[model samples]
Target: MHVVAHTEQPLQAHALIRAAASQPALLPLAQQLTDQCWGLLPGVHRLRFALRGDVPQNTHPASPPLTRDRLSLTLCVGPHADWPEFAEVLRAHTTGACETPVELAALQARIVTIIGAGVAGAGTARALAERGWQVTVLDAGQAPAAGASGLPVGVVAPHTSHDDSGVSRLSRAGLRLMEQTMRELLIEGVDWGCTGVRERRLPGKTRRAGVPLSWLNEHAHTANDWTHKAPPPAPDDAFWHPRGAWLKPAPLVRALLAHPNIHWQGNAKVEALRFIPHEAHLSHASTNTARWQVLQGSTVLAESSRVVLAAGPGSAALIATATEDGSAPRINPLRGQISWGLMADLPSGAHMPATPVNGHGSFVHKLASPEGPAWYTGATYDRIHGDARLLDSDHAENLERLKALEPDTAAALAPLFATVGSDAPRVHGWAGVRCGVHDRLPMMGRVPHAPEGLYMNTAMGSRGLTLALLCGELLAAQWHGEPLPVEGRLAQFLSATRFRSNA
Candidate 1:
C-alpha cells in the first residue's frame, strides 16, 4: 500500500511534477523551486511531490470540484543526505511551506498508494504479470482513470458492424472471451449482470421505404419486455437478447489492479519514446535519465523496461515516434455525454432490459440506486479534437434523441431538470469520453516498430467495461506466444494495420 517515494527510476516522479507545475497559477511558484532544486541536486536520482488541499474552483455546478485550501505538498529527492537543505529551498519558494519537501513526498506517495490508484496501465500490467510478465505501468495523472477511462459508468455491449464486418466479428469474438475473463478474474462489488443488447427494429414497414442507407442500415426491431412485470410471451417475430450485462467500470479497474504480478506507478507520464534496436527510451517530465525516471517539480520517480501508453486519447499525442507512412495508429477521441432519469411512473417489478436503442448510438440501462427507478439514458457521440468540455447543447440533443426512441419513457423520466421530492425517485447522470480506433474495433496488439517487449492494449472505444477483460486476455496470450482463442483472420480485425489500409 505504501507507494515508495522513488521507484527503480524517475519517470513517474517527473510526470507528477510536470502535471502539477503546468498549472498556470502554480507554474511560477513551481518554476522557482525547480530551477533551485534541480541546480542543487544535479546528481539527484529521484524527486517526489505530495499535495493536500481544498478542492479547486468550478464554474459549473455539476463538474467535479478541484482541490483548494489547507493544502500540503511533499517533495522527495534521492542521493541527498542533506534533504533538509533541499526541503528548505522548496519552503522558501512556497507561501505555506510548513512541511519539508522530502517529508511530504513520502507521505503523499504512501497515501495515494495505499488508496490503490492507477487505471488502464495498472490493470494491463497486473494481467500481464499474472501471466508471468514483469510489468510496470506508467501513468501521468495523480490517479488512474483521470483520462478517458474515468467515466462513472460505461456502456457494456458487443458491437457489431455490418453483417460479417471485420469489426463486428471481432466484437463477437471479444465478447465471448470477455465473458470468460470476467469469470476467471476476481473483481469485488463490481455489479455485473447480463441483459441482452438489441438494435431496435423499424417501427413499421412504411417508414423503412423512405430511407437510403449503408450496410449498417439494417431495419430491425429490438424488443425487451422488461418494461412489463412479466415479459410478454416470446414474440415469435421479436428480436431479443439472451445475454448482456451492466458493469461498474471503476470497480472493474480496481479488480484488474489486484493481481500480484503487476507493479504500477501513477503520475509516470512518458513524453517521448525513443526506439532502440532492442529497447525503447522514455522521456519523463522530470528526469533526463539515460533510460527513464519519475519526476516531481524537477525530480525523477521510476523507470522500467516496459511502458504501456494506456492514457486513452492522450496516448495518441505521446506516440508521435511510432509513425507508419506519416501516421500512428488511427485512434480518435469521441466525446459521449449522457443524462440519467428515474422512471417514476413505470409499473413496479419492471425488469430493465439492458438493450440499446440504436440509430443514434445512444444506450440505456437501469441501475440500483437509493433514488427510485433510476436509469442511465445517454451518450451522444461527438467527435471533438481533444475537447472535454461538457456542452449544454450536447445534453439537450441527447434528451431530444431519447424522446424519439421512447417518447413515453422520456416524458415519464423528466424530473432530472429540477428539484423534485426525494422520495419520488429520479435519475442522476454523467458524461464521459471514449477512445475509438478507426477500424471501429479496439486496438490491442504490440506496436510493430517499437521494441519487441512493448505492447498496447487500448483504444477500447465505447465498450471499455465489456471489452477490457477480453482484450487483456488476448494481449496476455500474445505475450506468451500461445495460439490465440479467436481465429487468426479475426485477430487481424483488431490490428493497428487498419491505420494504413485504404479500406
Candidate 2:
C-alpha cells in the first residue's frame, strides 16, 4: 500500500472544507475537526497520516479518540464491499460533534463515492475500458489532464534525432500509434495534420556523433562543414520530408474522456494504496464526505492483476509516498516556451525541420491558424526556476537568434512577428513545462523490485505529442505480458529501473 501526505492551504483544501461546512453554522464543527486532526498529527508535517489499503474497511474502529482533538479519518475507496465494521469505527469518532452521529456517518459514506479525474487515471481508464475492462479514473480536479497534461499544445514529433535513438524510436512509434488510434476513433478538431517542418542550417553546424541521422540529402540542410562557401539557397523545392503535425492538447485529452466503460470522477485525490498478496485497496478524499471514512467514499474501480502509473512528474512523488524503501527515480521538470507569429507567407511547398534546433536551444513549427500564413518559431528550454508566463525578453532574444540563422527567411518572418503583437506580425505565443527524464529519454517499464504490478510512462519532455501514444503502447505491452516490439537495449535506455539502481 502507498500513502500520500498532501498539504493544501489554498483552493482544493479550502474548497473541500467550505463544501463540508456549507451550512455556515457548521463552520465551527468543521474547523474544530480540521484543527483537531492537525494538532494531533504534529509529526505529520503540514498533513500526516499512515494509510494501508490492505486493512479491510470491515476492520472495527479503535476505541474513542485518545483525545477529542485527535482522530484518524479512514475513507474506504475502490470497489464497494461490506465495510460496515470499518464504517462504524469512523462513525464512533465523529459522534458528539455539532451534527448527529448519523450525519457524520453519511458524510463518511459520501467520501468513497468521489474519485479523482486526471489524464493518468482517465487516460489509462479509457485505454483499458476500450478493451472492455471496467475502469474508474479519479482525480482531485474537475477535469482530465489538469496536471502536466494541461498544456494548450504539446509539441509533437521526434526530438534530437530522427531514427533509432530512444527519443526518435519512441516518437516515431508514438506518432504512428496515435495516428492509427485517432483515425479509428474519429475524434474531430484534434487537428491532426501532415504540415511539413523546415529548418535553416547554421554556418558551422555539426551533427552529434552516435546520433543516427536520416532524411537529409544534398538539399535538405545548408552545408556549412566547408568554410568560405556560402550555403545554398534554402530548400525552396519540395524535395524531402521531415513532415510534422500538431494537436489541440486539451480537446484531445477531453476526447479521451468519451470512453463508455470509463468512469471519470473529479474532486477525489488518492490518499493511499494498499497491496495485498492478491488484491489492492485504494484510499482517497471526496467532496461529499464530512470527514475521511473507509468504504464510504470508496469504490473498487478495478482489480486488475496490474496497475500503471502515467501520472507525469507526480508519478515520482506518488511512488515515493507509497514505497517503504523510498526508492524511485525522480522526474525532472524542464520548462520550454513556444513563440508564435503571423506569417505573410510560409514557403508553400517547402518542408521544415521538425527536429529540435541543437545549439540554438529552440524549435520552430507551423500552426493551423485561422489567420493567413502563420508559423510558430519557438521554444526556449530553461531548466531554471521561473514562471510559465511569456517574457518579452525571451521573445526578443529568440527573434534575434532566429534571424541570425536565416536572414532571408527572417525578413519575411519579421513583419509577421510584429503584426502578431510583438515588434512584428507575431502577436501570440505560449509556454508549457516538459517532464523530462535525467537520461534524456522517456522513463518507462515496470518499477524495479517493487510489486510486479506497478508500471510507469513519463518524462517524455519536449516530445509529448510524438511520444505519448508510443509510450502508452509500451506500457500496454508490459501489462498484457506481450513481448515489446521496441528493442531490449532501447528499453533499458528508457527504464525507470536504471535510475533506481543507479541512485
Candidate 3:
C-alpha cells in the first residue's frame, strides 16, 4: 500500500503515526514505523511500514502487489499543492491505484526465476519473495556470492559530491535502506559493522574523483550526519561519513537468499532464454500468456512467467535471445584487486589505521579474516578486464595506490609487500570482476527492446556493496507500482533505456 499525506503541520502527522502506541493490539506494528519522518524538517520525507510473520490490519491496497498478499506500506509526505506532481509520478511509474493493464498483469504470476545468486540476484529475489512470489535463483557457481559479491569486506558509504549530485543522493537512499536491512537480517559484528568510514579525499591530480580542493560545501552543514568536513589536521579535502559501514558481501547474499519463499539453485549456468507465447484457457475471458524457459544448452533449468537478469555481466547474453534486434545492455567488466594480511604479522613499530579510509583507494583494518585479525588495503581498478587472477604485480599496484591513500600506513606495510612469496602468510591478494556502464550508474527495470517479462538489474560497478539492495528495491517498487525508494529523477538515471539510440 502507498499513501501520500499532505499537511502544513508535521507534528500532527507524527502524532498520528505514533497513534499505534496507544493500542496494545497495535504495538507490534508500531515498531516498523521507525524513520525520523520529515525529521520534523521542511522537506518531504518517506517512511516505510513493512511487516512479516504477523501483520496488523490497515487500509486495503488500491492496487495489489505482484502477489495479492502485499504486506508493505509506504507513506510519502508532501504538501497539498504538490498533488498534481505527485499524481503524475504515480502515472509514469504505472502504480496500482488504477485497474491493472492486461499486459502488466500477465507478468504478475506468483512464480519468478532470477538469474545469478550474487548480491543483485539475491537482493531482487528477497524483495519479490517478501511480496509472496515463489522465486527460484539460478547461479552458474556452486555457491552464493561466487562472483564480485564474494569480496571479503567492502564499504557501504554514501557517495559525496559538493553539489549533492544525483548519484550521491541515490547512494544516501541506498545506505539508509542498507542500515535497516543489516539490523533485521544479519548479525552486527560477524556479518557487518556500522563502523564509520573516514575518507581522505585527495586532489584530482592523484585520483579520478575527490571532494573540492578548497573544502567548502554549502550543503554539508544541513546534512551533517551524512557527510561533513573532517576535523583540523585531517587534510582540508578529507571527509567523515558517520553512517558508513564495512560489510562482508557473501554473508549478505546468503542471508537474502535464505528467505523461505526463495529457492536457490547452484551450478545452473543459464545459456539462453526461450520465449513461449501461448493462449491461456480462461474460464471467463481469453488472455495471452507469456512464459520464459531458462535454458542451458537445450536443457531447461527453470521455467517461469517472469525472468529477471541480475546475472552481472552474463545478463547481456540472455537478453540477446529474447530481443528481436539482438539488443542488450552494454555493461562492461571492471576488475579490482585488494591486498590483505594478518595483523599479528606486522613488524615492530608498524601501524594500521584505526578505521576504514578511502579516496585514491580504500584501507580497512581490525576486520576478522580467516588468518585472524587482519588489515586490508588497495583495490586498483582495471577497466574492461574480466580477469580476476591474483597477481604479484597487482599487489604492487595496490601498495602504490595505498601510498596515495595513507602514506604512513603504506610505508609501514612496505616490508610485507616486499617479502610476499608464494607461501608467504604476511600478505595476500583477492581480485574480482564487477560490471558497469559508461555513466557509472546501474541499469535496471524491464529490459528495453526485449520481451515483456525480461528485466535487467546489473552494472553496479564497485558500488555493488553500496547500491545492490537499493537497485533491487527500486526494481521491485517499479514492478509493483509501490512508492519508489528514491526520487523519480534519480530513478530515471538508472534506467537502461537511457542508452537506447534515437533516429
Q: How do all models score by TM-score?
A: 0.59, 0.57, 0.86
Q: Please, what is the whole-model Cα lDDT of each candidate in the order they appear? A: 0.47, 0.46, 0.76
lDDT of 1 at 484: 42
Model 2 regions more than 4 Å off: 1-126, 139-141, 158-163, 186-190, 199-239, 267-306, 341-374, 404-409, 412-426, 500-503
lDDT of 1 by residue, 429-488 (tens): 466667777556777666655443345667877766655555665565454433343444
Global fold similarity of model 3 (TM-score): 0.86
By lDDT, is 2 or 3 better?
Answer: 3
Model 3 alpha-carbon miss at residue 473, Å: 1.0
**Winner on lDDT (1 vs 3):** 3
Model 3 regions more than 4 Å off: 1-46, 49-56, 59-104, 205-222, 279-288, 422-425
Report how far residue 448 has shifted in candidate 2, in Å: 3.3
Between candidates 1 and 3, the TM-score winner: 3
Candidate 2 global CA lDDT score: 0.46
Rank by lDDT, highest first.
3, 1, 2
